[model samples]
Target: MDHYSFFDRDLSWLLFNERILMEAEREDVPVMERVNFLSIYSSNLDEFYRVRMPVILALNKLAKGGKQEKEDVLLEAQSLIEKQQQKFGQIFTSKLIPLLKENKVTLLFNEQPPNEIQSKITDYFFSQVMAFLQPIDLSETGKNFFPENNRLYFLVSLTLKDNSKKTILLNIPSNQLPRFYSVSSDDQQFILFLDDIIRHNLHRLFINEKVTGCYSFKITRDAELDLKDEYHGDLSEQIEKQLLKRDMGMATRFLHQPNIPLHTLHFITEKLSLQGSSVVEGGMYHNLKDLMGLPVSLPGLRYSRWQPLTNDQLIDAPSLFEYIAQKDCIFHTPYQSYNSILRFFNEAAIDANVQEISVTLYRVASDSRIVNALIGAALSGKKVKVMVELKARFDEANNIKWAKKMKAAGVEIIYSDKALKVHAKVALVKRLVDGRIKYAGLLATGNFNESTAAFYTDHILMTANPFLVREMELLFVFLAKKAKTSAGYPIEFKHLLVAQFNLKDRFLELIDREIENVKKGLSAGITIKLNNLEERVLISKLYEASQAGVKILLIVRSICCIIPGVKGMSENITIHRIVDRYLEHGRIFIFNNNDTPEVFLGSADWMNRNIYRRIEVCFPIYDQHIKTEILKIIDLQLNDNVQAVGLNENLQNVILEKHEPLIQSQQEIYHFLKQEIYDRV
Candidate 1:
């Protein structure tokens, strides 16, 4: 590892956010969609400060040398973020504002209304916003004024009649009401921030006080929870207790308006004990994530709606199990419908042949149809077991609630081992076929949550392959018996790559095989698509292979630490990142085994957490047809020029220049899968 130089993970993540910002800068994108990109950039940055900043802070608390190293990284990350924030402000003011004006929509930012809409704004503020206003005197609540995580607040500089100034912290209530209030005035549509509405009616709230100034601010607290594996108490209860403590965590970021007077800023920071926090100067609006919910409806302002296509195989089959039993089927989500996944659970619940079902629940939707189907199966007296990962950060409460519901419904809910999270997205169904036991498995590169399926690019393989399904059953049995056995239980997997056992070594072996092929003067190439690639062990292996002349093409969506195109280190490795309408959430790895390629897709990335700290699975694409389709899809993404950017040595997203034929991978893949439906018809 010392022989390799890696990019800082935090800095690399900022570069990824910069790519999302670049999408807003693209002129070809629809105006509203560009606004959505800005919202995504803002939302991503907020999460980074909440989650990743805490890790850096913890590292800084270590010995002197480590403290200095982490402090430097923190400074670099902050500098990059400041630059991105500046670009966001420029894009919003220069491009999006003017575009909205041209489309007969005006977003009023720091400007007085043109006298016609002032009355309407005042009326709306007094009626709607006044009730939610509860300003706390910071002088009274000093050091205990807990700014709830990620919520907007207005720090008011008030002057009383006696000329003594007092500061009040008021909640903006953006959570309770819409961030953008729409006002229709004589053929001209206008959108105003709820911040401005509150600003306009500030005098009404403080009757005797003279409001000298008001500035917007937001606080992002550390969101990481400390849930120890006590082995004595219930894991769900531990998680519930930690979720309550999330709001009381250390404040990581305090973002305030740039125009705040130095004295006011000092007062707020000192009173709130935010002396060492990352205090950032931002625009008048702090949480621009609200921009995503902008209430404006205009023709062609948004991306053309794309409906997920129904899979022809599932549509025509008399039974989903029967279809899967014949051949392996793949569903590329959002492009192809997720109904096939729903059908898998629904048919298993009602089909008399299904005797038992096992699934891994990571992040389930609030109103999960899959959970309903599992409950139905339990009510039907089928043996149902679920391994719900309760430590999926920010999704713990929802998972715990669903876990209780499933347990009450007689579903055997297996809580994840506190030491290892079950991040694998797999569901296994055991059915009695022809008086013998048979298995059907649904393995995917993403969660089983259907809501995310509508907007995430993932691949699900439905296979009744005896070898794979049997291995899946073995894995489930291991999970069911995990608590009873010691942590060192030897669970061997032959066909599938299981993390903590052989996934990491198996990947290394595959890469080494490519290196061996290159040594033998045989053709060797590696193509991988994953959300994050930060594990140094595998990265060093890839660098080694690159030196051996094994061409490596990586499509890493976020947090890639490996520096590509560096001489004597990773000169042959090329990294591309794709940020578009749908999140690129799938993990596909391909190795040219002496020209006969081996393709594998699964629920694991090369990140250390996924490889070492979680129960993940990466199964081989054994079926030739499905394998070819996966390869073709990866090829399409590799050749994409529309939404893909090359991650160069300088950590800049270099967009590939368009040739005669412009390739947008998502659209092309949709049409390609749509053609599959036509071919089947």
Candidate 2:
């Protein structure tokens, strides 16, 4: 049994979201940047409910009366989410908006209006926003109104003097039009929500009946689409059809204003038949995630943009291939330019000895220059094969678009079995050097997207080791055949932890070693940095190790289930979460076997889907200097008292207080890297 056997995974994820909110609530952070953090927190919560919570809820409903534990966890998750929503309300209303007002920006509503400014808003709405108003009458249509995913809606309840009440749903055209409408009169910039603009023009929207009141609201649906393997058609066409069906998915959540009347709430819930579903009562503003792009337009309100810094190694090298031949190089994205990854493919495309290029396309940019480079390679008589996964959620349409384009350019496209989505981010290049097969591969922790690479923290390893290259080429062949038995690629691996075979064993062995070492009175410990940690077996192993007196420190970015510091169960376990300016990605696991530690960097987290299902690799750090550098970064994050949150025995996120000077690890890392560049220069 795990130390955190009682701790729920869904509730732990909500705590992660709360840490993001803490960043927004920090007085030390820039105001506009804090607003962006708030938007990210909201967006993250939306995805949590859309993907995770619904599945948990569904899982609870299975086995009928049994599994009291699952039901209790769900109830706890629901309660925690409501608490977070209330905190979000307080932060947005009491703090962020007021700060914006101090900067002369106003988020206006209908009730609280200066008389002088009411006319300006009224005239602006009638002229510009009235044409966009399309209200749906629930009584007239006599059908349930369902909202599209992430789309905004208005819940208007009307009370006539004769006591006959009517309710309607209004669609706010924020996605089509701008969410924030800026109006300038004298000095102040009056920015109104798209819903508020429609609200001001309500007298015109209602034809005959008097408009009593209006409130902003919206509904979030379960965005998961069930695209089974039975569909015998073009995957792209099938995905396009699913994209259309997504808007009409079951409404899992109803987000509405708190002040809404009881009858009105009953009316909407009964009409939509949302009898057993979750109903989340929220503040006046429905979709605060839109505030990420708040149209601040003011230069000083946000952080100054920093141009991506190129690696000094790239600048000093004779050529990319030549440099790889000498030594392996890792490009940590955003800090190091994504242009280097692009250059690797582009150079391969133009190299004379290059024979073939194979890549796994999980998620790529719409305007992907990398795909264009692959197309160029194919056009230049290079055998280019792309295993494009068309099932990546939210990016399926974009992946489908790229697939059609790549296929049209004469590239061999391999579609994986629909049951398993190929999520490995790998690109392999085979070149004939003196008539011998020489290969180069790019393995990354994030999607091969240049735009997100600028903001997301990911590690891309570019290497040409013959043994590793041979394995990578074999892996590509396996991927092409969808890992079939007839595929020539061997399943045996000593240096790589490839999933479906050896990864789980390797991880379990590492934990078991720690447990044994602790029992032997030797120094034993484990340090892990991962995006999420929720695998039951893995968590249970950590608990067993902790019981054996093996110290464990986990820096999990999100979705942790292993409760730390339980008195008799997990006294040696500690969990830390770092929420800084840069996302803490790059999964690294270290096992301290009496001070002779083994460190590995990988493309997989400890989540069950990654360990048991996905084709993930955990490769050992060979270069001593690189290992030192990665360890240094991890240590900095561990020592961070500013952005770090400690999870206690009760699974509570408690911020560590420091009486001395603060050390923000992200900023410290920037300075650390800058110093390295300076020393090299």
Candidate 3:
């Protein structure tokens, strides 16, 4: 109820998520894609429960101990989510299902299985689904029936011959079977939830007992892993132990289908030892994120794929290494193909001249071609060093899997201190050309994983700049030693802004420069694009710059904590939140140095985690062409009316009024680059 200088980040995050729901509401959006938006909204909300809900619950209890600002925030978040869920249901039933039916696709939402498909559904239930079902009676199973976090389960009530009541828990094997079953009859397609198929055949499984009622429910638990400030043994082993217990964590949410009998709800809650505060009422579907599994059968309703553009210059180049050796280049993915980035690592693996390669991977793809290249590079006798952060949340298992594979293949594996995480997306390849140690570096705003690169918009700079490449190598050296902190390390990063050492200070200095230029009556402005903005010190400095008359512009994709456009404090500041088809993942900062603009891009988000807890790299853009292209892209985003929601002082998304030549930044940026790749690259 009270206004603070900064908005609560969690509350701001909830608003950003609501924007996804807004996309789903747009009539112009294709119906199938709209369904995907709904899926994303559900997926994002589930993750919010797993990751942030625990903190909210803890802080609310602590609020009782007098922090007191938000038990208010906790209640507001719950109420907001409740409203969003209702709106989600309305869209699903009234709008989306009607649209689907009009397109000759029946989603079979809350409705029963059509009589036509009953035989087929029953057959599949016995032949395929029955193998995965494990039914446990609550009375007989006693304390052994534990629900895994976020997994869907049906609580079925059965009536016995003796008139005694029984509750049974049936697993929804969505993990093993398709979440939805598609069947066609009378020229219409019906999509059935796997839950319904199993629910329909409940009587067959229970042959004698009458199937009285069935309700869906799932428990979301705290996902936090507690690692000591210092690890005494293997960090991977310690994390593996914690991961086994992750699903067993205390319940943060107990979401159930609406209108279950009160006694059943109470009995289940009591049996599970679920907190009273954790109970949440929901529609029939618990994990609607599985809606993504729905078949996209209509060609007319599907988004016309934008073919990822090719860097024609590198297409026929004899060697990717030699291409970078000629000049510096910036590669954008999903707009520009990720193949060039892939070929960079691929080339290094085979080139006889290449001697060593080093890269820091925060999150590696399950089938990472880059990691495979590293394995080949090591197999070919080239020295390879990789710092795989096993602490990348939700990605620890995949990263550990790759790390062990690389390690087994003789690649040197380096792990950061338990207290610190390596969040940098960078790589260095060294070659012996003409008896000289020649270096080429890969610096990007996203991970090296090609899986995410397909959808996440990120910038990768491929350069042979010795100063920058060598500076990157120094970072790898720091990781090789496994220094816990920057307290004793004396690496003066003149070009790279690395966290725990110079990143925070360097950013402050840049903001100070803009503030001083404003005082000198010169052209002064700052433009930054970040995924999140929560570091208070930097935000305060930006607030100071705004008061000093520096025009500040921000394009933050999610979780902005700073209060923008407030009188005197931030009157000269404006923030835009953009959500669209492709994720806007690049982080770019441009400061108008009087007249000439300076650009920097990297992995850091300016959040508290990035500023103090992780090793992030934000590198300067020295190439004139690269700087101009980045500025053009940012300029388009800043001017965008479509897909851009400007945040008011209250942290509400106010749609930008459309102007002449309406620009959707993602679509326009792609065309702009596609045109350039043909005209200039």
Q: Tell me the lDDT of candidate 2.
A: 0.79
When sorted by TM-score, best at the front, the candidate numbers are 3, 1, 2
lDDT of 2 by residue, 1-681 (tens): 522464667888888898898888887787889889989988988888678867776776773567554454677788888888888878878898898888888867435556767787777777777777677778665667666776888877665566676777888888778888777667777777777767767766775566776766666778887777588867678788989898677777778887877877887788877766678887777778888878777667777665666777676776788788777778776776788899998998999989999998888887899999999988888999999988888898888888888888889988876666677777888888897877787878788888788777887888887767777777786877776332345567777677776788889999999989888889889999899898888888888888888989899888887778887778888989888767877788899978878887878888877876577777776667667777877788888888888888787789898846677677666667666666657
Candidates' lDDT values, in order? Answer: 0.90, 0.79, 0.91
TM-score of each: 0.97, 0.94, 0.98
Candidate 1 lands at a TM-score of 0.97
Deviation (Å) of 514 in candidate 2: 3.1
Model 1 residue runs over 4 Å out of place are: 61-71, 141-143, 229-231, 483-488
Q: What's the alpha carbon RMSD for model 2?
A: 2.6
Candidate 2 has its poorest 10 consecutive residues by lDDT at 482-491
Q: Evaluate residue 366 in candidate 3 and report its C-alpha lDDT on the 0 to 100 scale.
A: 86
Clash statistics: count for each candidate: 0, 0, 0
Model 3 ranges with Cα > 4 A deviation: 1-4, 67-71, 141-143
> Per-residue lDDT tens digits of candidate 1, residues 1-681?
798988888889999999999999999999999999999999999899889998876676663566454445776788889999999999999999999999999999888777988898988987888899988887664335878999999998889999987888999999899888999999999889999888988888899999999988988998988876465678889889989999888999999998899989998898887876889999889889889999988989999988889856568889999888889899999898899899999999999999999999999999999999999999999999999999998899999999999999999999867878899999999999789998899999999999999999999999999889988998898888765332577667889998877899999999999999999999999999989999999999999999999999999999999999998889999999998899999999999999899999999988888887898999999998888888889999999998999999988889898896899999999888888778877
* Colliding residue pairs in candidate 2: none
Tell me which of candidates 2 and 3 scores higher on TM-score.
3
